[model samples]
Target: MAAGTPRVFISHLSGVAVFDPNGDQVGRVRDVVVMLRTGSRPPRVLGLVVEVVSRRRIFVPMTRVTSLESGQVITTGVVNLRRFEQRAAETLVLGELLDRRVRLIDIPGEEQGQAPGQGDGEEVTVLDVSMVQLPARRDWEIDKVFVRRGRQGRGGPLRRRGETLTVDWSAVMGFSVVEHEQGAESLLATFEQLRPADLANVLHHLSAKRRAEVAAALDDDRLADVLEELPEDDQVEIFGKLAEERAADVLEAMDPDDAADLLSELPESDKERLLALMQPHDAEPLRRLLSYEERTAGGLMTTDPIVLRPDATVADALARVRKEDLSPALAAQVYVCRPPEETPTGKYLGLVHFQRLLRDPPFTLVGSIVDTDLRPLPPDTPLPAVTSYLATYNMVAAPVVDESGALLGAVTVDDVLDHLLPDDWRESAHREPAQVPVPVPVPVPVPVRGEGANGH
Candidate 1:
């Protein structure tokens, strides 16, 4: 530990209230984002996931944090309202680091965290971690780990048998990528709090064997969510490894458009086999989607969109719009239809933007406030037409209606962007896995839990 370097344990920041420079409350810290580096180098702290008043989690870069004392965080007052989206190289310290089992490199004549009977590579369960700003630099890095000795139990580390200790970050091993026989259980448990896209990013960088193990361990809904965010080749590879019945279940959990997109990549026999395993009702939408050209509105549109009958109240529409799983684009508006609310819904009456829903009384009928001025796109609309339609109207999502004026589905901006971007875009932007150096014993002072060098 450096003599004058300021440091604070991450556990202290969990759920701490954050305020602006003027002292007005902004949000609460949810997690610290960091990028785990190669070898013994400490992971660089990136930012904080702050949950704002509306419960929308946003990122506050560490550079923006002016103070971290008194059990509260103070930011620069300027905060971005955009939701935090974890990237490929980033890791959430609180979500994916704590409770992880790592090892202490055996240093002759020097020890602290190791149990009495344990030899070299003593196992420890991470409890907390501390970050320190580099001397004369604004960047912060994880420098110390607070861990408990012994195997973890269902409740937690066995209280009677485990001894907690803190050690320098370099004294431990297993934080970086390594080719070994590690199971995915601990990794999966630590990743439970990550969003699907974030989890997909983690999986994208993992070894194929490890990726397969983790995919097999994930539940149908979770695997489906992760699959939707993965690259086409990865999706096919993972899907091919699942049991037929499990594959069918995962397909059912995926959005119809995504399921169709994935299925289009598989051989006809394989696609037919999986579709045959699925429920007829679930397979129908995929079948409809598969019938269209890959770049057409029908192909790009999600079969499921927010749909409400004309007579439905604004309250009911708002309730549907508030679902957490719906993307911002899909949640931007609700479609008003006659009946058979699911797409292809009965005669499309019009559409109601979320803003108009908010402006109207709760008891007001959605039909009354619906916007009929904007014309809907046909399923056969080309990709260029869909792009122009959305861009010209400044819309995040556009409606797709059949010739009979039935609400078919909706094409969201994300889907449009996906089609417009290069096929390898997702894979091209990520950084390669960091190199891991062999662990060597090093003599270093170990700090006990709850005490940082800065004495915070």
Candidate 2:
């Protein structure tokens, strides 16, 4: 058959002799197997089984089969039937390991529903019985074998489709008439589902190139999440493997605070190079963030705050709020500022609550409606004080100002939390207990008894 041509049912000519390339009779055809193709017109022959005199069965592909003549089969290569026999007897391969009925044991905490006798114990309580079978070549190795009802389309008389058990190659302990599928590919698939923190942990266990391969496979959003969780040093190191444009794309997709943090750790020259490669708009925010101290409110805050002109109507403010890509932390309140000044000094009058903005009349001026009682903090204000101020006012965020009272940025509650409770918060602090004053013990000068008293 042609390389890609589809084939139908293949006849298993039983008792037909199998011969080596030298024409010596070796074995007899035992079985012919067909692997069903989902979209193809006809199923194709996966391989052939030959039963040898040693009571061992070996699998040979139809591709290696040359011809079928009168009571004889011809093959291309002189495969040591012994080697094939040894391999078949030693390990569980696809054909023999499947279709045998086995019990399914659910791992604790992994069960979705409460089945009888299912708990956090290792007791091999039979949850369900299923027939184990080999998977197609394209299936993941860990999932090489599947479990299903032995009889197809039969009702109440036997097993139901719902009761069938599926076993992963990794879950099986031993193989008797069964074999486990490869686990490497399945592991990769499972790795893909892990959260960014878990994925970063796995990445720490892999080599740099493997890390790059796994990272390259992730979607932009997922990749950005993982990048944000990774150590700053690791971020720079892994980013080195990606193309400049690809790296720029990922950085652009990352949160402004996270992207700024990563860039801050890079050498100045590298930072400039990466920023230059990024989209102008994305790079602009990152540049602004980079200019601030890492622990400052401006550094921790997101630059995507919603701002409306003081002279604009509440309707216009509401419209702007609905249109901008504001973070949830900053979405509750919108700042009212003047148009971009020549020097861009913070000329904002106050902020308006989103609820108030929505409720006010359309013609109400934003400045007239804004809450002037808003609490503002300087960018240089300590994080503890910033957090305290927000807590005291019960504000989602407080506007950050420079020495000139020009609105530089707004610090959200989330940023304050991040600054106060870092990932390695404990590790960053001294481990020793704080010193406490101990009472000084008074020492009594013990007089030499005999010398102090007059000699007797």
Candidate 3:
């Protein structure tokens, strides 16, 4: 073990023969068990099992190793054959040694939300697996077959057992162990797997550019979910990287309230750009929501709700609901309102749960089916008070109305959570104060190295 010589582990010594100091061949070196010294412990080798007499087994202290050569090993002395006679069949077991070779896979450019199969339309490759062993954190079991020039070769393992190797598992395009000779470079080639929520958490930890790369790698639905979970600041930052049309598509896929909250944080110019790119129908609800104060009930409600005239048949209401693609938040309940009058004003009559509507006859008047005992909140009510009301009544959402009882919007449970606690609250709290630290003018030091014109 010279100071500059690289320390290496000898795996797969099965074909190497063993000899004693006298130059007589005793048997073969079946396996060499090395104890790994980790932390503050001194290094010690244990369980050195050797095959002898061509069919017998013997256990000897690693101190017996005289020298390891290219094709064989030399020992100080030979052991009694009878002592290993009973252990011949089990001498090759490397449970303690082999267990150290297990390694985890690491894939680059592939994040938690990206589809696992492909990356950016290109195939990914599974790189070499790393291995680690116990007690010796400094040493690794690297006896993997290294394929080079379309031929098989041997090399020391770079990773420890249970350690992960990031890889592109998309397709088996081609491979070369030389390509992964550098551990850091290899790890950088594979992507990491993470859940949607975890991905959002990671985005918050990354720079704006890195966040955008991850967002782009994800599918529309996954990116939308992550967008909903991200802080308003991060959402705006990441959204800036996407094309206006792509950004609008992601927003349209998001819950209207969540989309509104994100859009409200953008510059007015950027907001309008995104809105202009959105489908008119999808953009309409978000635009309307952006008009309201972020903390207000109207701002927190989804406008794409199911509404029916009190005089309309229950069947007709059901028909309208079935015909339209309503968001889950809006589809939870049906609001029964007065039929449109000449002035185009309608009154909020009552509410009907989707389940109840399905159980009643289609011809039944919506007013007859609407529960008169409606839990309604005024538009101007504070969000906290509205949350308390919902909890007290155990309601999924409460209808919001004007003084004249006109149906305005519905405040949902998700919106309530958003109103109560936004994602950036902590970051905002920990952020540096708005007032910049003023610079105190200091006396300037004159240069002494260079003298005046004559070089004095």
Candidate 4:
């Protein structure tokens, strides 16, 4: 680390507020741009990719950055409003570097051959990289590499590991012009371990082309999860890029309510085409959801909750919940129904909250202990009514029924919240002064200065 240089992990820069010299908020930092160099000579930071109030991405050259510190980045107020087009040689720290597996130049005997590797080096996953502004040149460069020594587990949570190595940038290898060309290749496996929301956050920071590339690399189920977390506009864009069959498969993997919401964002013709390509069983629920006004309970409920017979035992109910790869909210409760089968289920009986199932003996019949006190929501119930119903019942999920009392589906809390939020909530959430954005200007270089923020 250079003396008098302010050091920060690249992640700490993500979403931090960027202010002009006049103390006007320019935008929030979306990505850090760095040009790769030979021999791990701490790639020079090029500039920042900033999204302004209007959602336009502009570039603020490194030379314009007066300070780079904790919660804010102070720039010289000379932003180039001409949109940022990532050059072929530049690497986006958040978009392309984080989570990438790289080779650590192993010092022969010091490193046991435990880490996964190729012929020349030991493999380590880049958790983050620290960048610093050298006082003299006043330029930023990657100074330290934070890495987990192993080929990260793919497709699930990573196993806890040995101490993370905070190595000088030179001790790290693998970042190259070749990596920038290959795209998220070395990072996809690591991405598999991220929660859908986390992956969506990362995707939101990439260029459209790079975002599509990463989205294409994800498995249908993973892509579905990620898509559900994204804004509707983003959802539509990525879904449009998929082959119709693959898009249908991705929709099938999504919660029916989420899939319906996403499909509703499309032009009716495109929506219908995708629906036609889906398996009939998968498409039916979404079709029914689409038939309703988006603010209605019918439109917000997923048709895939674990459904059990009135005669089913706790053990049977437990088995169903375990068998399905349902989201937490969906798995929070089970519906007891009179049925020839689950979907288009016969009659809506009472419900059994998961906690109740856990409380009773395994052999106890779920129907015998059902909670019939909380009434099922009508398919036509409006969004406000649905929100109130959920809040009053203190329920994470509520069942929906048609006029005939046949079970339709169940609405989860998250779905209702999405509806209740402001139309631009997704965008606003990213830049709001009171939300994720730091309300205080941080000491980036000389001192902090901004509205709604205290200077250091």
Which candidate should be chosen as best, given lDDT against the real structure?
A: 1
Error of 1 at 259 (Å): 1.5
What digit string (tens of lDDT, one per residue) describes model 3 on residues 1-456? 112223333443443667777777766654444333333232233434554443334554444455555666676553433322212112122322221121122224433454544323222222342222323232223322111121111232232333333332122222221121112221112223444554565355434544665577667777898887766777778888888778989988887877888888888998898899999978887877787776777777766567777788878777766754455556667888776521112888888887887888888887887887866777677778888888897777888877887777788887787667655553442231132211212212322311100001
Q: Rank the candidates by lDDT, best first.
A: 1, 4, 2, 3
Report the lDDT tens digits of candidate 1 across residue range 251-347: 9999999999999999999999999999999999999999999999999999899999988999999999999888899999999998898888999
How many residue pairs in model 4 have overlapping backbones?
Answer: 1
**In candidate 4, how many Å is residue 272 off?**
1.7
Model 2: worst 10 consecutive residues (lDDT sum): 447-456
lDDT of 2 by residue, 325-441 (tens): 456777788887776621123576778988897788989998898788866777667777887889898888888766765676678887777667755532222111123221212
Worst 10 residues of 4 by lDDT: 447-456
Off by over 4 Å in 1: 3-182, 431-456
In candidate 1, position 185 carries an lDDT of: 56
Residue 66 deviation, candidate 2, in Å?
A: 48
List the global CA lDDT of all models: 0.79, 0.56, 0.55, 0.75
Count of clashing pairs, candidate 2 = 6
Candidate 4 residue pairs in backbone clash: 67-445
Q: Any runs in candidate 3 off by more than 4 Å, and if so which?
A: 1-195, 205-208, 308-332, 338-347, 354-367, 402-406, 422-456
lDDT of 4 at 368: 96
Q: What are the per-model C-alpha RMSD values against the true structure?
A: 10.7, 26.7, 22.4, 9.8
TM-score (C-alpha) between model 3 and the true structure: 0.49
